[model samples]
Target chain A: LAKTTQPISMDSYEGQEVNITCSHNNIATNDYITWYQQFPSQGPRFIIQGYKTKVTNEVASLFIPADRKSSTLSLPRVSLSDTAVYYCLVGWRGGGNKLTFGTGTQLKVEL
Target chain B: EAGVAQSPRYKIIEKRQSVAFWCNPISGHATLYWYQQILGQGPKLLIQFQNNGVVDDSQLPKDRFSAERLKGVDSTLKIQPAKLEDSAVYLCASVPGQNTEAFFGQGTRLTVV
Candidate 1:
C-alpha cells in the first residue's frame, strides 16, 4: 500500500471551491486514487476515483497528474454541510486489494 | 438496498473483560472488512474476508482479537482481556465484488475502562 500525506486541516467559506491535495510519493503503476468523505458519527462515503488525468462525477472531481505521485480532489460551490474529513486512498482495483487510509484532510466550511 | 448493519452502537467494559460486536453485510456482498478507528486517527484495517475465508489479518492482534464469518453473510469480532488502548470504534464494511465501492455501517464505539 502507498502511504499518503495531506494537509491536516483546511478552511473554506460558503460558495467557494475547495481543493485538497494528497501526495503519494511511492504510488505503484497499478494503484488508483480514491477519495472518501467522512462526517462525525457516520461512515465514510465514496466521493470520486481516478487513475490519471481527470475524472469528474456529480459529487466531485478527481485530478491526477501525469506523474501519478499526487492527486487533488476539487469540490465546487461548497456549503456548510460540506464540512468533513476527506481521505485519499491509493490501491489496486481488483483481486481483493486492501485500502489503507491516512489521517485525512479536515475541511471546515463556514458561512 | 440496505447497507451494512452493526449492533450495539456503544459499549463500555472494564479492562480484562471480553466483548463481541456483530455485523451483517449487505445481501450477496462477497467481501467484508473490519476496521478499528481511534480518536483523531484514520480507520485501520483489522481483517478482510472473502466468502467466509480470511484474506488478510496481519494487523490484527491474534492473541487478543478474533473474527469470523461462518456463513459468509454475518460476522462477529471478539476481543478478550481488553486493554485501555482498546477504546476505539469498530467499523464494518462490505463490497459486492472485487471491483466495487465498499459500503460501511455506522461503527460500534467501544470504551475500555
Candidate 2:
C-alpha cells in the first residue's frame, strides 16, 4: 500500500469550487488513486477513481499528474451539505483487497 | 438493491467480557472486510474474506479476536476478554470483486469499560 499525505482540514464557502490534493511519493505502477467522501455518522462514498490523467463523474473530478505521484479531487459548486471528510487511497487494483484509510481531510463548506 | 447490513448498532461491556458483532454483505458480493476505527483516526482493516476463505488477517489480534464467514454469506466477529482499548467502531464492508467498489454498513460501536 502506498502512503498518502493530505491536508488535515480545508474551509470553503458556498458556490466555490474546492480542490484537495494528496501526495503519494512512492506510488506503485499498478496502484490507482481513489477518493471517498464521508459524511457524519455515515459510510464513506466513492467519489471518483483514476489511474492517470483525468476522470470525471456526476459528483467530482480526479486529476492525476503525469508522474502519478499525486492527485487532486475537485468538487464543483460547493454547498454546506458538502461538508465531510475526504479520503485519498492509493492501492493496487487487486491483491490484498483491503482499503487502508488514513486520517482523512475534513472539508467544511460554509455559507 | 439493499446495502450491507450490521447488527447491534451499539454494545457496552466490561473488560474480560465477551461480545460479538454480525454483518451481512450485499447480495452476490463475494468479498467482505472488517475494520476498526478509533476516534479521530481512519479505519484499519482487521480481516478480509473472499467468499468463505480468509484473505488477510495479519492486523487482527488473534489471541482475543476471532471471525467467521460461514457459507460465504453472513459473518460474525467475536472478541473474548475484551480490553478497554477495544472501544471503537467496527465497520463491515463488502465488494463484488477486486474491480468493484465497496459498500459499508453503518458499523457497530463498542464501548469497553
Candidate 3:
C-alpha cells in the first residue's frame, strides 16, 4: 500500500475551481491513484482515477505527473453541494485489494 | 443498476452486547470490502473479501470483530461485547473486478451506549 498525504482542510467559494493535491512517494508501477468523495452520514462515492497523465470525467479531473509520486484532483466550477470529504488512495488490485485511506481533505464550499 | 445494499441503517446497543450488520454487494461483483469510519476521521479498511474467502482482516480487532462472506454474495460483520469506542459507521463497498472503482452503500451506523 502506498501512503498518501493530503491537505487536512480547504475553503472555497461557490462557482470556483478547487484543486486538492495528494502525494504518494512510494507509489508502485501497478498502483493507481483513486479519489472518493464523501458527504455527512453517507458512503463515499468514486470521483476520478488515473494512472498517468490526465483523466477527465464529468465531475472532476485527475492530473498525474510523470513521476507519479503526486496527483492533483481538480473540481471545476464547484458548487456548494460539492463540499465534502475527499480522500486520495493509491493501491493495486491483485492478491488482496488493500486500500489505505488518508485523513482526507475536508473541502468547504461556501457562497 | 442497483448498488450495494445494507440493512438496519442505524443500530443502538449497550456495552457488552453483540450486533451484526449485513451487506449485499452489487450483482456480479466478485470483491467486497468492509470499512469503519469514526467521527471526524476518514474511513478505515477493516476487512476485504474476494468471493467467499477472506483477503485481509489485519486491522480488524479480532477480540470482538468478525466478518464473513459465505457463498460469495452477501456479507455480515459482527461485533461481540461491543464497547463505547465501537460506535462508528460500518461501510460496505464492492467492485466489479480488479483495478476498478468501488461502489459503496449507505452504511450501518452502530452506537454503543
Candidate 4:
C-alpha cells in the first residue's frame, strides 16, 4: 500500500501563496500523485493530478521533483474560501488500485 | 456533469439498530468507493468496487459493516447493530477510468446514539 504524510495543519492570510508538501517515500514506480480539497460539510474535490515535474492549472500548481518521493501543491493568491483540508494520495493507474489517506493538511486562510 | 449522488443526507440511529446508505456513481464510471470520515480525520477507505466486484474491503469491519454494488452503477453500505463508534460521515466516490481523479458525493452523515 502507498502511504502519504503531510503537515497536520497550516495557517495563511488572504492573498498569500500557500504550499502544502507531502512525502511518499515508498511510492511505486507506476504511482501518480493526486491532491484533493475538502471544505466543511462537503465532500472532497479533486484539485490536481500529476505524474512528474511541474503541472500548473488555474487553481493550483503541482511540483514533483525528479525523485518523486515528495510533491508540493501550491495555491496562488488564496482567499478565505481556500481554507480546507487538503489530501495527497499516491496510487497506481489501473486494476482496482486503492488509496490510503493520511490525516491531511488543514489549511486555514484568514482575512 | 453529475459528480456522484448519495442519500439520505443525514441519518440518526440508536446503537444496536441498523442503517443503510446508498450511492450512485457518475454515469459510465467503472470504479466506486465507500469511505468513513470521522470528525477531524481524513476520509478512510472502507471498501472499493470495480464494476460490481469488490476489489478491497480490508479496512471494513466485516463483523458489522457490509456493502454491495449493483450492476456496477449503484452501491449501498449497511451497518447492522450499529455502534456509537460508527457515527461519522459516509462518503462515496467514483473514478471514470484508469489513472483518473475521483469525484465524491456530498456524503451521508450518520449519527449513532
Candidate 5:
C-alpha cells in the first residue's frame, strides 16, 4: 500500500472551483489513483479515478501527471452541499487491492 | 440496484461486553471490506473478503475482533470483551469486481461505556 499526503483543510465559496492535490511518492507502477467524498455520518463515495492524464465524469475530474506520483481532484462551481472530506487512495487494479487512505482534505464550501 | 445494507444503525454497550454487526452487500459484489472509523479520523481497514475467502486481515485485531462471510453473501463482525477504544463506526463496503467502484452502507455506530 502506498501512503498519501494531502492538505488538512481547504475553504471555498459558492461557484468557485476547488482543487485538492495528493502526493504519493511511493506510488507503484500498477497503482491507480482514486478520489472519494465523505459527508458527515456517511460512508465515502467514489468521485473519480484515473491511471494517468485526465479523466472526467459527471461528478468530478481526475488529473494524473506523467510521473504518477501525484494527482489532483477538481470540482467545478462548488456549492455549500459540496462540503465534505476528500480522500485520495492508491492501489492496484486487480489482486491485493488494498487501498490506503490518509487523513484527507476537509473542503468547507461556504455561501 | 440496492446499495450495501447494515443493521442496528446504533449500538451502545458496556466495556467487556460483546457486540456484533451485520452487513449485506450489493447483489453480485465479490469484494467486501470492513473498516473502523473513529471520530475526526479517516476510516481504517480492518478486513477484506473476496467471495467468502479472506483477502487481507492484517489490520484486524484477531484477539478481540472476528468477521466472517458465509456462503459469500451476508457477513457478520463480532467483538468480544470490547474496550472503550472499540467505540467507533463500523463500515461495510463492497464492489462488484476488482476494478469497479465500491458501495458503502450507512455503518453501525458503536458506543462503549
Candidate 6:
C-alpha cells in the first residue's frame, strides 16, 4: 500500500478554481492515483483517476507529474454544493484492491 | 438505475448488544465492498466481495464482525457485542467488473452507547 499526504483543509469562494495536491512518495509503478469526494453521511464518490500526466472529466481534472510522486485534483467553477472531504488514494485497479484512505483535505466553498 | 441501498439509516444500540446493517447493491454489479468511516477520518475498507464469494477481508475484525453477500445481490454485516469504539458509519459500495466507478449507498450510522 502507498501512503498519501494532502492538505487538511482548504477554503475557496464560489466560481473559483480549487486545486488539492496529494503526495505519494512511495507509489509503485503499478499503482494508479485515484481521488474520491465524500459528503457528510454519504459514501465517498470517485471523482477522477490517472496514472501519469493529465486526465480530465466533466467533474474534475487530475494532473500527475512525470515522477508520479504527487498528483493534483482541480475543481473548476466551484459551488457551495461542492464542499466536501476529498481523499487521495494510490493502488492497483484489481488484485487486493485494498484502499487505504488518508485524512483527506476538507474543501469548503464559500459563497 | 438505482444506486446502492442500505438500511436502517441510523442505529442506536448499547454496548454489548448486537446490530446488523443491510446493503442492496445495484442490479448486475459484480463487486461489492464494505467500509467503515469514523468521524474526522476517511472511509476504510473492511471487506470486499466478488459476487457471492469473498475477495478480501484482511481488515475485517473476524472476532466480532461478520459479513456475507449471499446470492450475490444483497448483503449484511453484523457486529456482535459491540463496543463504544464501534460507533461509526458503515458504507456499502459496488462496482461493475470492468471500468465503471464504484457507487456507494447512503451509509448506516451506528451509535454505540
Which ten-residue region of model 3 chain B has the weakest summed lDDT? B94-103
The deviation in Å at residue A77 for candidate 4 is 0.5
Clashing pairs in 4: none
lDDT of 2 by residue, B17-76 (tens): 999999999988988999998877888899999999999999999999999999999999
Mind giving the per-residue lDDT tens digits that candidate 4 earns over B40-80? Answer: 99999999999999999999999999999988899999999
lDDT of each residue in B2-85, candidate 6, tens digit only: 999999999999999999999999898888999999999888889999899998999999999999999999999999989999
Candidate 5 ranges beyond 4 A from true positions: none
Best by DockQ: 4
lDDT of 2 at A85: 94
DockQ of each: 0.69, 0.60, 0.62, 0.70, 0.63, 0.57
Give me the TM-scores for chain A across all models, comma-separated.
Answer: 0.98, 0.96, 0.96, 0.96, 0.96, 0.97
Evaluated on CA atoms against the true complex, candidate 3 attains a DockQ of: 0.62
Q: Write the per-residue lDDT of candidate 5 for residues B42-79, one digit (tens) a residue.
A: 99999999999999999999999999999998999999
TM-score, cand. 6 vs. native: 0.95
**Could you tell me every candidate's TM-score relative to the true structure?**
0.98, 0.97, 0.97, 0.97, 0.98, 0.95
Kindly report which residue stretches of model 3 are placed more than 4 angstroms away from their true locations once superposed: A93-96
Clashing pairs in 2: none
Docking class of 1: medium
Cα lDDT over the full model 6: 0.92
- Model 4, span A2-96: residue lDDT tens: 78999999999999999999999998899999999999999999999899999999999999999999999999999999999999999886746
How high is the DockQ of candidate 1? 0.69
The list of candidate 2 runs beyond 4 A from truth reads: none
lDDT of 3 by residue, B1-113 (tens): 99999988999999999999999999989889999999999999999999998988899999999999999999999999899999999999998876568889999999999
Instruction: Work out how many backbone clashes candidate 3 has.
Output: 0
- Candidate 6: regions farther than 4 A off: none
lDDT of 6 at A1: 84
